[model samples]
Target: MKQFKVIGVAALALLLSATMAFAIGAGVGRDGTIVGTKGKAKTVQELIDMYDSTGCIDCHEDAHDDWAASPHARSIYGTGRAAATMITAMKNGFMSWEYSGVKSTKDIKVEHWMGCMKCHLPQLADATDEVAVELADTLNEWYANAKKALKNPDDKKAIAIRDKHQKTLTSLNINCLVCHNRMAITHKWTDGYPQHDTVYGFNDGEHEDETFTKMKRSLIMDESIFCGQCHGMGPNLELENPTQCATAYGSYMWAYRAEGGQESCQECHMEKSGLGHKILSYSDETMQKMAIDFKVESYVSQWLDGSTLKPKAVVKVKMVNRSGHSIPDG
Candidate 1:
């Protein structure tokens, strides 16, 4: 009887230990993440402030500068084109669709904008529906003012309005927190959720930052899958209305990895290319040179046709994509 009781206690202890382990690894029960702690941002500026990484510049000046030069900095307002496209998608796509639930900019919700913002500004997920509507209206105003400014060229009011909205749109981007914290862990249940006060990187230790005082190691920080989360495969079916963007990661997996190519996105775009935080594509001259190899051969030959000899010019061109994925990928 005593032996049976001992066995029962031992089994109970083991079960409790397993349960505790699972709880710790379950990632704060969903509402304990940084975004959750902060709650949903109500405005565009509030959302920008929620994921602000301006303080990072004090310690990581070089990385900040490099990142500022990258498209990630102005992700939503990419050379003024991205903002226009966002508005176009809202106006043409959401408004035109019968069941999108968005008939106008005011009707826009967080889910409606997720198709674009999912990559451009993942932080948008932490914002309220009102923020989404505000962002849409702001982009529309920016587009209209920009057009007026282009026509007049000297209308300071139009130019000022355009610039003001541009600044707001550009403020919300894939900043340090978005990468090193929010998106640092893909398998949250396995690796544990990214803590609000922890900055994930190559090592786990004490950090000097005020807000993010602890540094934790991210398993996928240097992996291609880290970038793949946003770069994507094909159409994003998760949303009610799917939106297809860049398939570079898809091509990289099937075309490159399937064929035994072993390079990661960071290996080519960051390390070997020496672009570092300024992760560029074909836009930068260095990336352009690294992505492709071209060769041309031309010769003049004499041909005999019946009794007459004719001169013929022949040109041979060869090109190869040396990058990991397709040449013209988004």
Candidate 2:
């Protein structure tokens, strides 16, 4: 009876000590997360400056180099395909797609292409959802007015509006935190604009801010669902490509469900050479070699001239997929 009493007292004492330590904020490490006014960046330049100061490249130089070479790094900046293609088109007064029904760029809406900002522009994603909505409305109003005025080739107003929006589009870009930052938290105001509350969270287990929840939930952010938010959409989700480009997640669920969907998209697509951050696509030479088996087959066939072709003269190349999911997926 005395031993049991002593053990109970000791356990209670330890619990109290732990509670006191947390209460006093003692022995707890600081994560060094800084925030701008109201926890949000006011302008595009502010967001860019904050991203630069993170100094991720300083510590992870190899990873940075690998990432710089990747499509993700160039997705919105530094002559990336999306930005280069869209910016040139917008400048030339062309809009989104050149489909069978759509005759010219002028027929497409600017809002249609701007939706790319949701996935391709990390800084914009960091903003509050409300701010995104507000910006969309503002851009749409400008686009409608600009389109109406552009009916007259001599209208300077139309030219100015297109130029202004194009400048803004090019100025906005994706940043590293869009994918890696687990806790990209923002608050919504009663008035409907995004309010910054806190920055990315550290691993410390405290619920004082939203960062705790974000970090907790994002421990497995490498999963396919993470990529699905953008890649799961169909061709018409944004700029309307010729075919369905962003059906990775949906296809995985449909085809890979038998395996309990155990394999992650990253397992194959993102080959981790070192820091596990330099993500690669399936088209990468290394990935291609890893995922495909190429072979040659030959057979005799009758030619159009009615002559029999010798073996090896008529040859066919065969390629097999080792990938668990569909190839050429976004």
Candidate 3:
């Protein structure tokens, strides 16, 4: 009976230790998340497959199509410019900085690329360091071949290399799962961590999807603060070397909200404009017209200088920013 008692006490102690460990692990709220469940991706393609939302098109065709047309779809390869800029930042910014630890593209890791990818492709966080090296090499290859193709327009090999890398980069983007699942909630403690088998939006019920079989309401989905998570204030200071991207959210708060403006980002960019998932800004013609009001006046006048009469043309222009933030926000 004494031996049985000792065994029971040992089992109880073991259970208590496991409970403490689980509590510590769950403190950050990543315990049951997709990344937590499936584990960090070992390669770029693994990362892509982990967050793929192509199945969403079966039920959400219109939203998918609209999103495909948006910059979010090709975030890392935005019209080829974003990809080039990332490479430029690596070569000029990282390699040039003595403390950056990046002697060349081969030295670049996930931490090094997160300065840009933090917003451009947040899911890169879920990828291993090897994936980051692969991405850097791919981007460098694409940029070199693209430049060569520009110089030698008829070079099929260069064109093919550029196109192939471009496709790979575009495959990773801010897709449906990114918004509705991964980044759906900011206050995890208050609302609970985003579940691995759940989709978050404006509903709470059984979801038809196999992987994500449940749906929950997101508290800030329609709020400007939601968009502000990525379209952030100046400089992500949390990184080893801070990178300043968009200050639109900061401007919106200080310039617009502080001065009695009442419109949310979704109200202007989504609802009233009717762009839906295509969420465009200054680049779209409709958004351009909606963003600002302009007035111009021209007149001819006579001026006298040193007893000589001369005709002068005068032009007057007035412009007002109608959007929530500045005209040229990042």
lDDT of each: 0.89, 0.51, 0.90
Task: Show model 3 residue runs off by greater than 4 Å.
Answer: 1-29
For candidate 3, write residues 282-312 as lDDT tens digits: 8888898998898999999999998999999
Pairs of colliding residues, candidate 2 = 39-196
lDDT string for model 1 (133-191, tens) is: 99988998999999999999999999999999989988989999999999999998788
| Candidate 2 C-alpha lDDT tens digits along 42-66 | 4545555554424555655776677
TM values, all candidates: 0.88, 0.53, 0.91
Model 1 RMSD vs true structure: 8.1
Query: How many clashing pairs in candidate 1?
Result: 0
Among all windows of 10 consecutive residues in model 3, the one with the lowest summed lDDT is 20-29
* Candidate 2 global TM-score: 0.53
Worst 10 contiguous positions by lDDT, candidate 1: 23-32
